[model samples]
Target: MVGDDFAKLFRTFEHTAFRLEVRDRYDASYENESLRKFLAGEPDDLPWIQDWLTMISAATQRGLRFSRVRVVSLPLTDYSRFGVWCSQFTNGAGEDIRYLPRPEATAAGLPNHDYWLFDSCILVRMHFDDGDGFLGAEIIEEPAVIVEHNYWRDAAWHHARRREDFATEQRIERY
Candidate 1:
């Protein structure tokens, strides 16, 4: 699913595997806000990301799997709470998708690509800038790229801080 526009891009997939790797707080915020607003009784203002979340929810309702991975510069301020809710829409029987810190993600050798990289045969991405705009990318049928991204994910996974469970630190939601 590749398109310069979000509507066209998302419209191409009704049921397909998605391995998403987002790199920044804004990216995470955009996605999280879009999904959370919809789930929390707000109207679907950002229908694009919300639809995917809805799809994941529907799949879970039908006992299917929806996979995802989030790579961010820092931990989301309220990941634990968000995780509990997001679990209702994932491949691991509603388990929270893995969240990897940027350094960890870098260590994992996760392929770092611009927004366009998501259009490859193995990944999907929504591209945005600090200006609060949006676009989409998809990568399918690209094994080498996927392998690279996989390694990156591993390194990221190991380096990401699961600080949510630790009592010594306080997280300030900077976004």
Candidate 2:
């Protein structure tokens, strides 16, 4: 499914929509312009960010929690740095975004692929290409898979640091 479908699913979740992002970089076409600007040391603003913030705010206002744990490498990639900068918007909008260094995430046995677990049940496994470009998502409903994802989410969240704290500790400037 496309991202819009995921957004729709977010609106339907009753309690939580948790995401585990286990990627060092993403090369989605839509993000190219913003990524380029960030690499050039320009302001981290992206035109599409407000729309996402609005969605997150709306969900959280309804008492539905939205959170994500991003697994990043030590000497962060440009993409990861950009993500750290942009996270302030999401965090401000009430999403509890966190970051876990790759080494810690791997040692914790977190899954290699990215996924979104909604309401602690449905799992949407996100697929990407060799260059880390998004392909699509598979909606998995099997109880066993969902259970494992829940476990991974719990582990990752436990080991992760809130984005603000992580950024400060790592000396990552927002702009």
The alpha-carbon deviation from the true structure for residue 18 of candidate 2, after best TM-score superposition, in angstroms, is 0.4
Clashing pairs in 2: none
Please provide, for model 1 over 141-171, each residue's C-alpha lDDT reduced to its tens digit, 9 standing for 90 to 100: 5687666655554454455444233212332
- Candidate 2 — which residues are off by over 4 angstroms? none
Q: Residue-wise lDDT of candidate 2 within 27-115, one digit each (tens)?
A: 76777888888788877567867888998999888898999999999898878888998898899999999999999998999999999
Worst 10 residues of 1 by lDDT: 166-175
Q: Pick the candidate with the highest TM-score.
A: 2
The lDDT per prediction is 0.47, 0.90
Candidate number achieving the greatest lDDT relative to the actual structure: 2
What TM-score would you give candidate 1 relative to the actual structure? 0.49
